[model samples]
Target: MDKRILVELTTEIVSAHASVNEMSREELLDEIQDVFRKLNALVGVEG
Candidate 1:
């Protein structure tokens, strides 16, 4: 919900994978889930 978080996440996702056109939906979902987990840990994984 935070703008900074959104931007950081988008930047990470885009930088890692370039274009969504090149990644399958499930593959992208997996990458997103991984990034979210890492970000959550950085925030102390509280909620």
Candidate 2:
């Protein structure tokens, strides 16, 4: 992935984690997993 895009994704993940403190543990895990899948696709990684 391009550096800029990677940085943007990182920022997005951080923001999501920081802002969704009220979410249940399961929901937060799902959200993090979704972000990882997206980042993997962006980097051409099969997951």
Each candidate: what lDDT?
Answer: 0.65, 0.67
Give the number of the best model, judged by lDDT: 2
Write one digit per residue (lDDT tens) for candidate 2, span 1-47. 56566557866885677695777778767766677667767685422
In terms of lDDT, the poorest run of 10 residues in model 1 is: 38-47
What TM-score would each prediction reach against the true structure?
0.51, 0.50
RMSD of each: 4.1, 4.6
TM-score for candidate 2, residues paired by index: 0.50
> For candidate 1, what is the TM-score?
0.51
Model 1 global lDDT (CA atoms, 0 to 1) = 0.65
Q: Which digits, one per residue and each the tens of the lDDT, describe model 1 over residues 1-47?
A: 55467548856775667563577778677777677767666664323
Candidate 2: C-alpha lDDT: 0.67
Candidate 2 versus truth, CA RMSD in Å, comes to: 4.6
